[model samples]
Target: MVRPSPTLRPLLLAGLLLPLLVGCRYTYLPLIPAPAEVALPTRVTSAALTREGGALVLRARVEGRFEPGYLSVAWFDSGRELGRDSVYLDAAQREATFRLEAPEAGAYRAVLAFGGNVLRQVELYEVEP
Candidate 1:
């Protein structure tokens, strides 16, 4: 059997405790932004939500000569842009999905835009305990 030396024991202990202490010190703020605007050029086939690896995933079905598309998930209410992530699609795709980070459990929307124009918007409700 091998045991860590006295000097090495402290470093190992500190490394393990550092993460625990850091985790407790951090604060998580959920997205509670103002209502977002809805302007659509055309409606896409469908937009829905599903759970993937414990994360909120927004999936959209789109088509046509979009060439370029944008996917975003945002929360809004009381007039503010709570939290949002907008990413450009590699290209126009029939099925696209974006994962929402630990957003505060609240009302949110997933929107797909093609060439700066929204193709679909779907409402989402995050159930929190």
Candidate 2:
């Protein structure tokens, strides 16, 4: 059987504990800023139904301030994506308008993506028979 010398035993113990001491002092740094507050659209001013056409006219104003970067809009129906659009903004825009045709009646949701963050807003409408 072989045994470490007394001097070597303390050195080996210190080497193992050194990693633990350093690891305990370690902290994780955030890579990006935390999500900021996003304001939901206040009114659906241009939303309406027309008897002349089978499609429903949908329009709304989304108001919010976000960090300047790539922005995207994803339109959803009952959690399903119907369409999406993307835009690049160097400066923050407080308001934007979106227009789309509603082929059928169902619940709809809108999601805004900026950088690595996402904000969601939802609305529901029904078509008359």
| Candidate 1 deviant stretches above 4 angstroms | 1-43, 51-54, 69-82, 86-92, 127-129
- Deviation of model 2 at 88, angstroms: 2.7
Error of 1 at 15 (Å): 99
Q: How close is candidate 1 to the true structure, as a TM-score?
A: 0.47
lDDT of 2 by residue, 22-94 (tens): 8886366685769997675322223222222444333333344445555566777775778876666543443
Lowest lDDT block of 10, candidate 1: 73-82
Writing each residue's lDDT as its tens digit, candidate 1 over 1-129 gives 999999999999999899888888636565576788865444467778665555667777664445565655564422345566766654445566777664355555555666666666666566421
RMSD of candidate 1 to true structure, Å: 22.9
| lDDT, residue 118, model 1 | 61
Instruction: List where candidate 2 sits over 4 angstroms from the true fold.
Output: 1-67, 127-129
- Please give the CA lDDT of all the candidate structures: 0.62, 0.55
